[model samples]
Target: MTCKFILVTGFLGSGKTSLVKHMLSDWGESARVAVIQNEFAASGVDGKELKLANDQFELIEINNGSVFCVCLLGHFIHTLERLLDEYQPDYIVLEASGLADPINIVELLQADELSERLVLDQIITLVDAANIERSLAMLARTRHQIMIADVVLLNKQDCYPGDLTELSRLLRSMNPHAAIYPTEHGRICLSQLTESSHLAAGQYYGRQSADRPEQLSACVVRVHQRFTQENLNALLAELQHDCIRIKGFVQTPEDVTLSFHSVFENCQVAAVSSYSGAAELIAFSETLTSKQVRQIVRRYAS
Candidate 1:
C-alpha cells in the first residue's frame, strides 16, 4: 500500500511539535504511524520530546539543516526510501523544520523515486495567532508556508491578544483554497486534518524555483559542564535577543538531562534522560554571527 504522507510546516515556535504529539496520541494506536522530524540543529530536541510523549511510532530525526535543502536532500530521500522498504507504515508524518519551505518539499515528493510509493496526503500549516503579522512581514518563507497549505491552523488562539478578524482575513488572502481552523495550543479535530483524500501532485499551489533562497543559519554549542537552573535561565535570557529559536539537550547541575526549547521570549525545559555526551544548545538567529554565538557558549562554559 502507498504510504500517506503529510507535511506539517510553520514558522519557528508555531507549535508543530505539540500538534504532532496530539495527533500521535489520537491516531497512533489505530494506525501504523511514523514521523520524520527535521531540525536545523544537529541535536534532536524535538525527537526527544516526541519519544517522551509516546514510543509506539517509528521516529526518524533529520537535523543540521532543512531536509529540502540541497545539502540534506540526499539523506532525506534515502531515509524515505528505507522507511518504505523496512517499516511499511500506513501513514508518515514529515514535521518539517520551522524554517523549511513547503514548496520545495512538495517538489521532492513528486520525485520519481517516491511518487509511486508515497502519496502527498496534505500540507498543514500552523500560524501563531499572536505573531502571524510579524512573521508574515518579516519572513519570506512564512508566506510560502501559508500559500501551499491544504489546511491552515491558526494556533495558540488562547494567548492571541489581537483581533482574530484581521488575522483570519490575512490568512484568507494568502490561501483562499485552504481550510482555516482556529486552535488553542495546537489542538484540533483529527478528522479535519487527516481524513482528506490523497491530493494529486498538482493540487498543492506554488512551486519552488530551481535556485532556493538562503536559509537562516544555525549555531550549535556543545557544552560539557552541568548547569544550574539559574544558570540556564541566564543563558536563555541572553539568547532571546537576535535568536529566532533555541533547542537542544542540557545537563543540569542536578545531574538530570533536560530538553530545552525557546522561541522568542517563551521557554520550556522538560526533564529527560541522562544524556552522556556533550550537551548541546542549538540557536537559530538571522542577525547573530557564528563568532558571537560561540562567544555566548564560552561565557556559559566558564
Candidate 2:
C-alpha cells in the first residue's frame, strides 16, 4: 500500500518542531509512521528536535536546499524510495524547512516515481504570530510557503493579540481556500493536522518569469495608496516580479492605515483602521534584500 505523507511548513521559530514532537506521541502504537525532515541550514537541528522514542516510527534527515527543488530532487525521491523499501511505514510526515514553500512539495507527491510509493495526505503550514511581521518584511520565501498551505496552523497566537479579524483577511488573500487554525505554542490537537484526508493537487510548478512589464525590471516598485478597488488592481500589475511577496500597512489620504500582504503573485489590501500613518509597503524579490527593503519602506513612509 502507498504511504500517506503530510508536509509541515513554517518560518523559523514558528513551532513546527514542537508540533511534530507532540504528533509522534499522539500516534502511539495505532499508526506506524516515518518522518522525513528537510533542513535548509543546519541538518541536525530539526531532526534532533524530533527524537523518536522507539521503533514504532523512523526518522530520516535530508539537509540541503529543499525536497522540491531540482538540485535536491533526485535526493528527495531516492530517500523516499529507500524508506518505502526498508520501513514501508503506513504513513510519512515531511517537516520542510522554515524557508521552504509547500507548493512544490505538494507537486512532488503528484508527479513522477515518488508518487507511486507516497500519497499526499495534508499540508500543514505553521504561522508564527510574533515574528510574522518581521518575516514578511525580510523573507519572500517564507511568505510563499504560507500561500500554498492547505491547513494553516497559526502558531504562537499567545505571543500576540488575538487579532483574527486582521489575520483572516491576510490569509484569505494569500490562498482564499485554506482552513486556518490558531494555536498556542504549537498545541494543536493531533487529529486536526493528521486526520485531514484531502489529497494534494498534483500540478507541477517551476520558477517562471514574471509576465508584467515591471517584472522585467531589477526592482519593481508597488505603492498601495489606499484600498480602493481600482488602485489595488493597478498596484498588483505594477509590482510583478519573479519570487516576490508584499507586506506592511497602507494609508489613504483619508487617514486610514490598512494592513497589506501579498504571497507569490497574489496580493491582498484592506482597510484595518484609521491612523495618521501614511500607506507603507515592503517588498521581496531576488533583487530585493533586507537593506533594499528598508530603503523601499522608507520611501513610502506615511
Candidate 3:
C-alpha cells in the first residue's frame, strides 16, 4: 500500500516531540510506521525519545537548521527516499523544526519526484498555548503555519487561564476549516491527527478578517515571577480581554509552577512542570500596538 505522510510542525518548545511519542504508542501493531525528524540542535532529541520504539518503527533524523531552506531540501528528499526504500512502511511522519516555515515544506512536497512517492496527507501543527497568541502576531511563520494546517492542536493548555470563546472565534475567522483541539502536554486523540483527508488546493490557506488586522501583528512575552495566588489570578484576569491569548507560568505560593491557557472567555489551568523558570506569557491580538502592550505589562508588573 502507498504510504500516507503526516507532516507535523510547531514553534520551539512546542511539544511536537511529545505528541509524536504519544501517537506512536497508540498506532497499534497493525500499522507499519516510519518517522523523520528535522532538528536545529546538533543533538537529535526525537531520536532519543523514540529509542524504545526503534525496533518496531523506522526512525530517521535530519539535523539541519530548518527544512524550509533549499539547502536542506535535497537532503530531505534523499533521506525520505532512503527511508521508503528500506522500510516500505504504511505511514510516514515528518516533524519539521519549530521555527521552520510549514508552507515551504508543503510547497516542497508538491514538487516533482518526491510528490510521486508520498501523498500529502495533512499538515498537523502543534501550537504552544503559552506562546501562540504572541507568536501569531509577531511571526509570519506562526500565521502561515495555522493557515496551512489541516489540524491545529493547541498544546500546553494546562498553563493558561484566559478565554476560549475568543480564541475559537479568532482562529475561526483566520482559518475556518481546520479543526482546533485544546490539549494538555500535547495529549489528544490520535484520530484528531489522522482521521481527515488533505484539504483541497484552494482551501489550504485562508485570509484573516479585516477587523482582526491586529492578528497579523501577534507578539509573545515570558515573565518569570513568584506570585501570591490572588496576584496571579489578578494578573491573568486583567489580560483576558486585552490580548488574543495569555499563557501564564505562575509560581504559586504553594511552590507549584502552575500553567494555564486562555482563549477569549474560556480559560483552562493546571499544574505543569515543577522546574522553575521565569513565567512565560505570550499575548496576541489583532492590530495590537506596542504601546498598548507595554501598558498591559506595566499594569501586571505593578
Candidate with best lDDT: 1
Model 2, range 249-299, lDDT digits (tens) per residue?
Answer: 555566555555555544556665323333444443555554565444444
Can you give the lDDT of residue 73 in candidate 1?
85
Question: Model 3 clash tally?
Answer: 24
Per-candidate alpha-carbon RMSD to the true structure: 2.5, 14.0, 8.8
Arranged by lDDT with the best first, the candidates are: 1, 3, 2
Please give the TM-score that candidate 3 achieves against the real structure. Answer: 0.65
Q: Per-residue lDDT of 1-302 in model 3, one digit per residue for the tens? A: 46788888876557777788887888867789898887653334345446543346888888645666666777888777787788888888888765566665556666675777887787788877766786776667767677777888888777756786667676667677788888887777777676754662235333321221223334445445456656666766777666545454656666776666665555656665434345555554555664575556556542
* Model 1 per-residue lDDT tens digits across residues 135-231: 8776788888887788889998887887888889999887777888899878887898865433332544356522333556777877777777677
How many collisions per candidate?
A: 0, 2, 24
Q: Highest TM-score: give the candidate number.
A: 1
TM-score, predicted candidate 2 vs. hidden true structure:
0.64
Model 1 residue runs over 4 Å out of place are 195-206, 209-215, 273-278
Tell me which of candidates 2 and 3 scores higher on lDDT: 3
